[model samples]
Target: MIKAKSRPFLKHGKPERRPDLMNLTDSRIIGVYGAQWRGYLQYYLLAHNVWQLNRLQWVMLTSMLKTLAGKHRSTVSKMARTYQATTDTRHGPRVCFQTSVERAGRPPLVTRFGGIPLKRQKKAVLDDRPPAPMAGRRHSSELLARLHCGRCELCEQRADVHVHHISKLADLAASGQPQPQWTQLMVRKRRKTLIVCPTCHDHIHHQQPANTPT
Candidate 1:
């Protein structure tokens, strides 16, 4: 079973230190092994400075070397923690490695079952639909004709309020549910009722008992 080591504690048991040199050096040795296997050690050593690399950079370099050698490469994360001891830091550097091989000629085009060719599909035309009217939806306009916001129980800012419904219009329409008449009655009866915002409306529904009778 794999186990995570506790990071070394600094003053007040805080762990904040760079990775040790042994880990970085091991990664370099693995990188050299990969380079030798790839038959490009001389070229790699001449072109790149492997000795000056950090843990993350070393992992990336080693992974690249393995790829060039046509061998299965270790994951960057695994390479980063290869020589990690119990006193090593947990929050080490993250590395991702990628490689590309040159293709000499055109590759075969094979289609899988149920796959559509890209060129056969037509581009969608713009709908050009007019914007929906918001005259009755405005908070000030809805409150000017109504008495309550229908969400919060507090009575303040009636003019700057909105008429909120307990059930959403889409949900009611989809499920064929009847609109609650108490919402309408509350709006008409109280002249200075609660004026809740959208956030409060959502919060009330979220916090309310889920199984309570509508």
Candidate 2:
């Protein structure tokens, strides 16, 4: 992972095998014309109430749009050089859009990334429920990685493996809250989970007993 202190440049490196992440490859059409594109993007941002994003974020969003629009891969560096994008040194090498020609209108010049809206979880007011049964579930990838040191807990499959949950905290709590989506987990949740491959996880879940294999 590149340090925030170091400026990120366009460079390709060897792909690291991460057992926790599920990668998907697909292509989409991004049809946004010059004037119409800007208008649409601005409207999207305003609709989401997230129009005040920084330059780097805007560049990333614009790049994605442009890429989907069947244009060349435009990047932050290219935008900075060509669009006269400014840089902010207060934190790190973050590109600023305040000085660019694209900086106009109250809704910002970039569109907000589509994301899952989070609902504030309500706390239990009165408690008088039976003790929830211990439900065995998978654990967090980070926790599993730390516990087994990036190796599958079952067969010790080190490469191209997946994170499995031994026991779920939410299941144990039985809070009745809807399980968060994968994107929500990526953004916020960080719980200790199990690590296993697809075959191993299926085997352990079906043939073998849950939380039995140590």
Candidate 3:
């Protein structure tokens, strides 16, 4: 009797991609592989020989492209040609694969790969705390620290403050109408997200302009 062949992806110690992910969209496939690449990079970011990870990068990139092209029954080079984009980074311009998912009332979530630098940080200090004004913190870190305090930026309340977001600033200007206070704040602040108390958020959503506290 002849033995039945096992699926390659199901074989022991095989380097096959996940069969469960065969039907996911291109963006999602990229996300899965991008997470793998990012996690790998993060774990080895401090290694002295971190630059050598470029070989693994190539392997993973090809694996991702092959998975994607296989799903669509197309060639790897065709898949590369379709989703490839040039992104400018601190290191300079590099070709990356990219995709976006749009929401009805929110800005599109953009995903890309191959832009991260693999340089080991000599002065790297990993801090688990929320952002403080210390040497290693970005300005956005301080913003996150403030968010964790549960203080409303608009009303200065000490209660549950939440993020209020709109699709984009251009969407606001497209209406050509007087914007609500929270919307006005977002425009003035040049951000699509606003931090406000529930009360203020309700006022903004309900458009209670006459008595809105902003």
TM-score list, all predictions: 0.16, 0.19, 0.50
Q: For each candidate in the order shown, give its overall lDDT on alpha carbons.
A: 0.31, 0.33, 0.64
Candidate 3 residues lying further than 4 Å off, grouped into runs, are 1-17, 125-214
RMSD of every prediction = 25.9, 20.6, 15.5
Among these predictions, the greatest TM-score belongs to 3
Per-residue lDDT tens digits of candidate 3, residues 64-112? 7777777666888998998898888778887788887654457776777
lDDT of 1: 0.31
Ranked candidates (TM-score, high to low): 3, 2, 1
RMSD of 2: 20.6
Q: lDDT per residue, candidate 2, 1-214, as tens digits?
A: 1222112211242212112221110011111112222333333342333333233333434443333322223444553344333343434454323211122234423322322121121341333344322111223423432343334545655444666543444442343443333312322334434455677666645543333332
Query: Judged by lDDT, which candidate is best?
Result: 3
Compute the lDDT of residue 135 as modeled in candidate 3: 26
* Model 1 spans > 4 angstroms off: 1-144, 147-155, 158-160, 167-195, 211-214
